[model samples]
Target chain A: MERLAFELESAGPPAPRAPPVVVGVVASGNLEVLVEPGDLAGRCRVEVATSANGFAEIWDAVLRDFAARNAVAGLALSVNDAGATPAVVSLRLDQAVEEYLGQRP
Target chain B: MTPGNPGHLPARRSYREATARRRLAGILDPGSFTELLGPSERVTSPHLAGLGLAVAFDDGVVVGRGLLGGRVVLAASQEGGFMGGAVGEVHGAKLVGLLRRAERERPAGVLLLLDSGGVRLQEANAGLVAVSEIMRALLGARAAGVPVVGLIGGGWGCFGGMGIVARCCDALAMSEEGRLGISGPDVIEATKGVEELDAADRALVWRTYGGKHRYLLGEADLLVEDDLAAFRDAAAALLASPRSLDEGALAREHERLARRLADFGGCTDAADVWRAAAVPDPDRLPLLDADAFRRAVAAARGEEP
Candidate 1:
């Protein structure tokens, strides 16, 4: 098992009041994302726990891209990955954010 | 689309291969099922992430309400593809909540599409406690006169605590491929040695705890085909004639279970039990068709065949 954490500052303002959201299942080739309100000062904190090790750079790249594209400030995002590809990881992150904002994706 | 409405129906698929959501859709009336804690709710487990295991939004169990043959019913289906459909804290709690809801709402019946390998090994203690809670909830639902029907035909058959849970239901529906046992063959072989129970002998394992054997032993109420339609029809029939959970039925069940335990307490081989039940040529029983096996068991029991 591998545990990784990351923090990134977003250019946009903090997200509005929103409830926490979870998306996806933790099965082979799949992952689940949990997004909740955080006390970060215009920055998003991300933590990932994965069964497959040696994927720190991949996770960092994915989270960095996600933070740049989404206004995730003041939000905490966690992921439970089970050897999922980068594409699936990105999709679930977007889904978690969309669900947290109470919007259909 | 709601569960029961007929606007859209999924392509015909085998129940054994269908996902948990697909199974629920097939059982309920089209457009009638309204999930209580849907995936959108995102009520995931708080424990698995720490262990570095994957977590699911719905905790691997899908619980909701739907109309089965025009009667309101509470339904739950386990996702066999997720961690072998094992019951964890959140998954078990969902089931407990559904059963408790049945007690209060008093739906036509409670339908459980069980595909669990029992408690989750990762969260062993929590899973065991949750199963116990589910048992208590089942008893409560029974006391409230709510029928609980379990269907076991998914990739993983009911085992561990769930095997007993299925037996506690008012009725159980099973496919020929389904198995109902407390301990799996692997566990038994590991603990008692391969000589005691060969784990690799699939035929022997099936003969011991498979649907046909359980049906013959009067454990499973209905034995149908592997198709979803067969299961739906059986469920409809069961819900139509809800069994009363009165003292008489309780006493009968108690006596039946006690007699069963006492009758086969010392028997190691399934064939011996069959022979004691007066099943002629007990060795050939496993090869019989479902209908034929039912008739044979009834004839052996001196019931109308």
Candidate 2:
């Protein structure tokens, strides 16, 4: 298993206050993302645990891009990956954020 | 697929490949499934993340209320793709909660889309306790005159604690591909020598625990094709004329189970069990289709079924 954690600075203010949210399932070629409120000030913290090893740089780039695009400050984003591609990881992150912000009914 | 749109339709799909959400949608009246503790709730398994394992948002089980054939029902479907649909603490709790709701609300029936490999070994003790709680909840629902039906056609055959739980339900609807067994063939072969039970003998495995065998033995209440619509229709019919869990019915079930135990206590061969059941040409039953097999079993029992 591979374990990695990082914190990224967001461009805008923290996201709207809402309850924690989780999205997706962690199966082969799939992943689940968990987003919870945190005392991160204006940053988003991410921790990833994956069954496949040696993709730290790839995960870092994907999470970095996501944090920069979304106003995800003051939140902790955790991912349980099971060999999911970069596209699926990004999709789940977007879904989790949308659910947290109540963008979905 | 949209809420409150009776005309909305989902493309016909095989139940075997459908996801948990899709199964619920296919089984319930279109737009009638109101999920509780949905993925948006973030109610994941705390133990899995702590142990460096993957954690699902709904903890691998989806529980909620839905309308089936214009009747209110509580339903649950296990995500077999997630952790082999193992019953962890939260997963089992969801099922228990649904059954408890059924007991309280007294819905027309409770439908369980079971595709689990039983308790999650990662949280062994908690999973076991949760399964026991679910069993109690199921009995409570039955006592309340709410029929509990189990549908087994997921990727993972029902096994372990869940297998026994399925048997305890008022009725079980199974497909040919589905299996119902206390222990998996591999587990038995590994624990006991190959001479005791060969894991590689696929034919033997199916003949022993497959839907056809169980249906013939009266373990499974209904054997149907592996189509979501077929299962939904069967469930609707069952709820339309629900089974009673009255004193007399319970006594009869008790006698049937006891007789099963007494008849097959020391039996290992599948043929022996069939012969003991007085099924003529027992070797041909397993080769027949589900409908034909059901007819043969009914005929053997001298029933009008």
Candidate 3:
């Protein structure tokens, strides 16, 4: 497995009231994301432990895009991935954030 | 939106297809579920990190307290998506903790939404030991007058150690999609070859281990439709009638087992066992729905249909 960590500057507001939330499951071609409150000084952090190795660049791009699109400040997103595609990772990230914000679709 | 209050639930969905967390919500009262040792706690499997496998935050089993029809209850839902909901060191520890809590707290009942394929092969010995501890804890809870009920309705089904664990519960409510057996069809086919048991034949596999056959054979206590409300209702009703685990109960169970073996031990297929049970047309069982099959079995047993 490959462990990847990233800390990015957030463009959206910090989540102080939102509760921690988890989404998805760590299955083949799938992943689970846990979103918790973090004291990152208005920044977002992401940690990925994936069984499918050698995709650091793809994860980097996906997380960067997620940070830019979502209000993820003061939040730490941990992902347990099992060969999930970039799309699935992004979707789980969005889902975790939405659940954390007490919003459901 | 509280316990005993009817709230807006999702439209009818198959219990077998819902996620572990979703199953918990569907089973318990709306807005009364509070997850313990949840994914946020990050109490993941310690052994999976070294093996380079994905480790779930809640260790594939979600355990917590909730209200089931106005009564407080401790519950656990095994996530089949993660490692086939296999029992590892941490996963089994969570379940053990819940059962033990039930013994101490004496909640309404311990609801186990079992969907495992058994012990996690990745954890190997540790997983086996965890399952053993779980069995001990579960039986302990039962002995303490805390009813332990199980529901088996998932794509993976309950097999291996979990199957044994399911039988240890006071009662089991299974959906038509649920299956219960010690050795799974694929495992049997792999070990004894396709000639012994063809795993590819879905019909044969279901007939041998599915809910309908198990209920007919007296393995599953109640057989219901695949709907979530059906499972919830079944569990609620089962909680109202907790079976005893005293000496008398054990002796009766032993006698029943002995009688079953003596009468159907020579039978190789489930149809043969059903025939022995006096089901006039065993072949028609699989084709009938849960309600229809129940009626047919009742009719064959000379009960009011």
Candidate 4:
């Protein structure tokens, strides 16, 4: 999970407009996330700070998978967690991105 | 047959079962409770179990509608046995929804049997948002002439944002075994040293944070025994009573809370407050039970208990 203070980066076309950057609590034993459009167009860099450490590799792997599957670029993803596992985190992150993109005009 | 006794102890189970049992037996009549998203409905929190936490079908709070003294009532009760009666997303959602239903019905009133530590730290954001929604719903019900009676008699009592939520209610009732405070002894102990709050000092802590103390300080409207029947009766009576708060009364209540913070400025012990409130022999508080505590305090003030 990510802390209140988190940042991310991406490469390619800058977001044409400011995308919805939603951040907040997920649930107990759950995770909260923030996904916003960024300046990069082709690359996505994810940052995670979690209460449960020693799981950073899993977090990176989840992000890698999410990036590989989605055309989501120039976007930032951040998470805050109490004890949310990597898979659940990935799912929520994807959901947030999906929800935000759906809201795009 | 003895009065105030259900004559048989209710069946026991996990937090979910206890919640169902309590909700079923709490209202004015048997067979009156209609659960919103009960166990058979399977509205458990996907957010909790996804993270490997034991998730109950009801999440943590039981929400439903029933009859109380011939008037319709919607109520919510927390399950302290589960996750410290913590508030998760669905738990908070169910609560907000129940309050919404109460406002919609606007029949008798809404009752909340709260025993939560507030904002499930796991689902922090969702829980926080849900609490605000519940508060808004409560305010709506109040505007519609529905009184919101909060019962703070669970083992966990209330804390954090939930504590604030309970305070926002029109009135509150409690029992000796229950507590009502913003933070737990451990949290205080962690923030301050043991010397500051002394989590181990049960007597001091109880007098300072217990239901009896809050009742004396006027935080709780009713103080009764811990038996479930007592609570049920109190809820019935409160639901029928004229709602004492409206838009203006509520706005002024906030002022009273702020005054509490100011008047209680930097006090180290409850004994100080006892002396400040001018109770006789504030030092003699630890020896009193519920009845004795009430009697001693009242007598100290030259009044009948």
Off by over 4 Å in 1: A1-25, A29-50, A55-81, A84-105, B1-12, B261-266, B302-305
Candidate 4 per-residue lDDT, tens place, B208-267, comes to: 888877977778877766656667777877666645565686678789878777766666
lDDT of each: 0.86, 0.86, 0.90, 0.70
TM-score of each candidate? Answer: 0.76, 0.79, 0.94, 0.66
lDDT of 2 by residue, B245-302 (tens): 6789889988988988899867788878888888888988767766778778888899
Query: lDDT tens digits, residues B88-151, model 1?
Result: 9999999999999999999999999999899999989999999999999998998898888999
Name the Cα RMSD for model 1. Answer: 6.9
The Cα RMSD across the true interface for model 1 is 3.6
The window of 10 residues in a row where model 4 chain A has the poorest summed lDDT is: A1-10
Clashing residue pairs for model 3: none
Give the higher-TM-score candidate: 2 or 3: 3
> Residue B160's C-alpha lDDT in candidate 2?
97
Provide the TM-score of the second chain in candidate 2. 0.90
Instruction: Score candidate 3 by DockQ.
Output: 0.87
Instruction: Output the chain A TM-score of model 4.
Output: 0.74
Candidate 1 on A6-102: residue-level lDDT in tens? 9987888898756566566677998878787887889999988788899899889988998999999999887777899999998889888887887
Local lDDT at B39 for model 3: 83
Q: Which stretches of candidate 4 lie over 4 Å from their true place?
A: A1-105, B1-20, B23-27, B242-266, B298-305
Q: Candidate 4 chain B — worst ten consecutive residues by lDDT sum?
A: B12-21
Off by over 4 Å in 2: A1-24, A33-49, A60-79, A85-105, B1-12, B261-267, B278-281
